[model samples]
Target chain A: MSQDQKRDAIIEAALKRFAHFGVAKTTMSEIGADLAISKASLYYYFPDKINLYAAVLLHIIHEAEQAYGPLVDQEPDPFKAMDALLKHRTEFIIKYYNVISFIRSKHDIPEELKPVFGSVHASELSRMRKMVEKGVASGRFRVADVADMGSLLFECLEGLRMMYLEQASSFFPTPEQFHNLLKREQQLSQIFFNGLTV
Target chain B: MSQDQKRDAIIEAALKRFAHFGVAKTTMSEIGADLAISKASLYYYFPDKINLYAAVLLHIIHEAEQAYGPLVDQEPDPFKAMDALLKHRTEFIIKYYNVISFIRSKHDIPEELKPVFGSVHASELSRMRKMVEKGVASGRFRVADVADMGSLLFECLEGLRMMYLEQASSFFPTPEQFHNLLKREQQLSQIFFNGLTV
Candidate 1:
């Protein structure tokens, strides 16, 4: 295999392993075994276990960024664009639950590796900023302080996403009443627009 | 020490050790050592490590219940009752961050002890429900679905408390803000109450 192919294999294998076991307990040997590569070959592609872990995380974040990147579009139809972006996000959560969990719990990750992670993180906020600007411009969202709104909205959505992942079986909103797959996407969209409105 | 005193000491030691180092790593003998008791003597009070862990959790929960029980009265004024209950809960969090964190994480808590744990959980919910009923009765609050509103308001508060705990340094919200602990709380609260009338 080519060097790049080997590196890619190592990252994909490591993500699968790390998602299940977490980075602290996952070992170089286990990662190599998952890739069906010799430990020596694994070391050749990535200098160390930490480096390999960073690559895996960066790949996961990059993929997520691509999934939610549409939110940054300067759409004439702001609400529709938002609807699409958030729908995309909810879909991603349902599909890539493990990757999202890893991203959420990345505090244990080294500061040096955050640059790789920052690429995706920056896009999320930028996307929100664009969405808020569009909403304000179109006179649909009557809110000041995009900076605060963007940050708070991100955290609220993050909380909802995490809560859904953590306690889906226990007390998840029923689609018929609260929200299901289709209805959750709808509720989240409506909640953001209406926003504690009387 | 007498048997009851020794048991309390052991449970206290478990709380201290578990809070510092987490549950699985802290051995039963380590707690016994902290309590100045022998392993056999510790076993005399609680048959096993899990049982001892359960005792520690129950003790903390009981302590909190004792502290907050009297505040949960069915008051003539809902707002007053809610204000008092939340104040009591807020104090408990400030005073016993460790024990609350331990309970929140479900650290060392066994499956069978869940029902006992749940009663404590129900009491907390009952207080929120009372507040919602008062809001509806007073007509000061918009009433669409009181049950959902009660739960969502509680979740928002829970989310706020957790954010304050986890990211307090990142976003240092002060208490005087009225709606949220953040600087924007006052404005946010006004917007929530009065709507976008401006």
Candidate 2:
């Protein structure tokens, strides 16, 4: 395999192990053994366990971006685009539920992952802004300040997630809890979007 | 003083000490010292420090209720009432910030305060329901499910607060952070209420 392909292979292997056993319990040796690669090669690629974990998170983010980035143009209707985006986000979060659970705890966030998370946050905000602006351009949304409204909407949705996160007893939320959160998001999003509708 | 007055006095004294020094540092002896009452008298009123802390939280809730209860009728407009209620809620949070900070940390919640906090939470939801119902009755709010919307709004506001609380470096939020939270609440609240308005 090419160098880039080998790195992707390593990340894929590490993601499964980390998701199943959690970051702390899953070690580099186990990951290397899973891929039939030597520990020296794994270390050469990732340097450490934290670096591999950060790469996994970054990989998921890239996957989510690829899945949802075209939603604005594909959907045409801004309202529909936003709804689809949120649905994609929900699915992405649940798909990587166990991996995401590490960040929810707040204490386990690795230093290398902070910038990855920060960039991801900024991109999410920018996406929301673009959606809101699209709606305004289409004369469907009656927003005064598109950027401000976008940030407010994003924060409200985040608050909804945080509400459920706080209520869950375990790091990973139950499916039912995730269901309740999605319902709240839909309900809240409907009302919020209606307010913006002209 | 009568028994009731004595208990209130003890709760009042403990509030000041706990707010300034936090629950970990403040002791029953210091509370009694603040009130010039003996430790025995303090114990008579409150079985232990935990009980006293719970009472203090309850006291503040009662104070907030008394301060904001009439806004639904007093403001004459549902939108205005909610705005005033949210404003009062913000002030109440900032006013008793240090004490409330204890709850934000999550791990420090006293066992005795669980029921008290639960009841306080239920009452807050009930109050929100009442306001939304009043708006619907006045033909101002076009809500299909009054109870659901009320709960959704309350949860959204809470999410806003939690967002900032999670961002804070210390147990208590700084003034600027609180200001930003209030701005987000107002912005989000306006959109939410507009969506509900007829």
Highest DockQ: which candidate? 2
Clashing pairs in 1: A175-A179, A175-A180
Off by over 4 Å in 1: A1-42, A47-57, A76-82, A97-134, A139-145, A168-189, A196-198, B1-85, B95-117, B138-145, B168-198
Give the distance in Å from residue B76's predicted Cα in candidate 2 to where it truly belongs.
4.7
| Worst ten in a row by lDDT for model 1 chain B | B189-198
| Local accuracy of candidate 2 as per-residue lDDT tens digits, B1-198 | 999998888888889987888877888888898889987888888888788888898898888887777754566576788778777877888888778777665544667988997897798788778778878888888888889888998899888777778778446687667878888887887888788887
Can you write out model 1's per-residue Cα lDDT over A152-187, one digit (the tens) per residue?
655544444434433443333332322344444344
How much is B190 displaced in model 2, in angstroms? 1.6
Each candidate's fnat, listed in order, reads 0.02, 0.80
Those runs of model 2 whose alpha carbons end farther than 4 Å from true positions after fitting are A19-25, B18-25, B73-76
**Model 2 chain A: worst 10 consecutive residues (lDDT sum):** A101-110
